[model samples]
Target: MRVALGVSYNGQSYDGWQSQPSGRTVQDQLEKALGKFADQRISTLCAGRTDAGVHGLMQVVHFDTSAERAPYAWVRGTNSFLPRDIAVQWAHVVPDEFHCRASALSRRYAYSLLESPVRPSVDAGRVGWVFQPLDLAAMQAAATRLLGEHDFTSFRASACQALSPVKNLLRIEISRRGAYWRFEFEANAFLHHMIRNIMGCLIVIGQGKQAPEWIDEVLAARSRDAAAPTFSPDGLYFLGPRYDARWGLPDRTPAYDWLP
Candidate 1:
């Protein structure tokens, strides 16, 4: 049987989502806990792969297992062996055709940034910090140029294995609450380090370092060197993917509302 799970984690402790030789990844921990519970190996495929130090509010994954257990049981039993930073939020039985990644319509991510002079102490690894006050209008204008389908090679990582540099960026919402800025992104897909690179450009524009039209030049260049450096992964959060209503999967976890 195939089962789907909504998982959340603080990525500060893990290398990334994918399994590695060190076995310190979120996938490694979840699979190990799952193996302990089912008495057999259970491999999972996730909706999106996040980088190290990036958080996941509701990362969806599907795994096939011979273990016969109720959805709630799968959630409770699996989490029993998992670490405090990671847990299964919900579980559901899925059809054979359901895939965690390929079946998704779009994915969402958010970056929480702190605009202040002093460095962050309590929220050091939870938010990105900049000393200068950002111009929200400037950032918004620069972000507007990123909407729609385009070759995002300028912002893609050199190590990105994605077949194509083109992706349909559906939305980019920038809002500020107090001293914190929240940048929300929705897209059909994203290349490795795409959002982080774009964030660097936005921060530059917001700080009056460049004009809003600078993004257009970067896109036209289609070169990684043409864009700003990749921003820190500390502030990034995977908000999960959007599946069809027929899947009956939860769109979000409690952590969604808790994010700044």
Candidate 2:
């Protein structure tokens, strides 16, 4: 039987979401806990792979296992062996055809920024910091140009392994509350470093370093060189994927309430 899991983690202690030789990734830790609980080795495939220093509020993964246990048992059992920062939030038995990545209709990400003169101490790794006040009007204008399908090569990392540079960016929502700002993105898919790279450009434009029209020019260039440097990963969070209602999977976890 195939099992789906909703996971959340503070990525500061791990390398990233993917497993590596270092065995310091979120996947590595999750597999280890799952294996221990099942008393057998287990492997998983995730909906998306987040970079180092990026958190995950609701990362979905699926794995096949013969071990018989209740759905809630999978969550409570696996989490017992996991670290404090990482957890299995939910578990469900899924159809054989349900794949965490391939079945995903879209993926969501959120970046939190703290616009303050005082540098972050408590929320250092949880937010991107900017001393200069940002222009909301300019940032909104720039972000509007990024919506819809386009060739996002300018915002992709050089090491990106995606088959195509084109992607459908479904939404880019920007909101602010006091000194905090949140940038929420939903896309059919994303290339490596795409959101971070776009964040860099938006920050530049918001700070008046470039005009909003500059985003259009950058998109037309389709060259990474034409865009600003990739922004910090500290503020990035993988909000998980959206699937059809037929899957009966929870679209959110309690962590969603804690975030902007």
lDDT of each: 0.96, 0.96
- What lDDT tens digits, residue by residue, belong to model 1 across residues 1-260? 99999999999999999999999999999999999999999999999999899999999999999999999999999999999999999999999999999999999999999998998889889999999989999999999999999999999999999999999999999998999999999999999999999999999999999999999999999999999999999999999999999999998988888888
Worst 10 residues of 1 by lDDT: 251-260
RMSD of 2: 0.6
Give the lDDT of residue 200 in candidate 2: 99
Show model 2 residue runs off by greater than 4 Å.
Answer: none
The TM-score measured for candidate 2 stands at 0.99
Model 2, range 44-88, lDDT digits (tens) per residue? 999999999999999999999999889999999999999999999
